[model samples]
Target: MPQTVKLRPYRLADEPAAVGLWQRSWQLAYPQIDFSQRLEWFREHWSGLQLDSRIVVAECETVPDHLAGFVAVSPRTGYLDQIVVAPEMQHRGIGKALIDAAKHLGREGLYLHVNKDNSRAIAFYRKSGFTIAGEDINRRSGAPVYMMTWRPAADLPPEP
Candidate 1:
């Protein structure tokens, strides 16, 4: 892992690398799924989904044009559509950094639907202060998923 990881807004130039990272991350997480086949679809919706959202990308200083990970969040609705981290970059705090950025952007709350079978992600979200509020099925994949959410703590009255 590199000593420095920087976060920035997603640019049109980062499209290919971002799309590639999305594929690689999903492939590593679920080898049974051929994510390469979905590259075109992902590319099509990558930026389209971020139209009213903030897409943040994390890059390693050690390697130029290296995409460590990225998170796409909609502050308007506090919905997090995607958070993908490079396989090699896992456990290096890049994922956490991306999530932190998401939290900052979606201040009202952060909501996301993660695959139910993805225990690693579920656990990570829990550790990051998100809770499983409900469940749903992915319309495209028909996979079971948990609707998780995180809201900043609010101050209570000093005395009731």
Candidate 2:
């Protein structure tokens, strides 16, 4: 991990790095699925999705152009649309930083869906204070996913 990882609002120039980061992370997480086929779809919808949500990126101070990870969160409903960390950057607190940023933006709660088969992400979310809220099928991919949610109070210190 670098000495500093800065979180900042999404910028237009960050799109390419963001897309590449998402592609690599998703590919590694879902090896059975060929994300290349849907890369264009992600590109086309990237702008619109971030426009409607709070998108934050984690950048290492040493490597300015290298985007370690990012998270897309809806402030209104606290829906965590997406969070991806570069394969090389996993387990280094980038994802947690992104989640913390989402909490700051959406005090109501933070929620997201993870593929049922993604045990790694499930465990990570569990460690981050999220619980399985429910299950649902992803409309586009028709894959089963577990809806996970985390509330601000979940991590509050016990009343003394």
Candidate 3:
């Protein structure tokens, strides 16, 4: 049987692994960007954010020593700041579990911005029930991003 995966709050000890995951995932998803700049951005934005804002790490029962994935949520907006699974461990339900946990925390809905050119993420978010709410130019990356949102089950469908 497949091992169970546990989701728990992120600790300061997990920073290195989390940063490594962020670096690798970003490199795979946005290869054209300058590496140093991307790292700097992550260091500045992610590092400075309120840690208790809602960050969780996933670990498999069989190999509890390593983190398999992580999700970070903003307290105010309930927005998903980041959700990344190890490259070798994608599509094994890690992302879904993390998302479900976020929803369970009373996050009525969630939203995230994805680069317009990142078709893979766009597809994944769509499959996960997010719909494009609008598009806007991202000054930092010089790329257009699709602002996607998942409304509370009782809310009306987002107008296209």
Compare the candidates by TM-score and give the number of the best one.
1
Candidate 1 local lDDT, 1-160, one digit each (tens): 3477888888889988998888888898999999988888887788587688889999988788899999999989999999999898889999888988888888788899999999999999999999999999998789999999999877522311
Question: What global local distance difference test value does model 1 have?
Answer: 0.88
| TM-score of each model, paired residue for residue | 0.92, 0.91, 0.86
Of candidates 2 and 1, the better by lDDT? 1
After TM-score superposition, what is the CA distance of residue 111 in candidate 1 from its true location, in Å? 0.6
RMSD of each: 4.5, 3.3, 4.7
Worst window of 10 by summed lDDT in candidate 3: 151-160
lDDT of 3 by residue, 36-122 (tens): 566767877777654546788887777865788888887677778788988877878888877776665435788888889989889
Pick the winner on TM-score between candidates 2 and 3.
2
lDDT of 2 at 141: 93
TM-score of 1: 0.92
Q: Please give the ranking of all candidate structures by TM-score, highest first, separated by commas.
A: 1, 2, 3
- How many clashes (backbone N, Cα, C below 3 Å) per candidate? 0, 0, 0
What is the lDDT for 87 in model 2?
Answer: 83
Query: In model 2, how large is the Cα lDDT of residue 123?
Result: 93
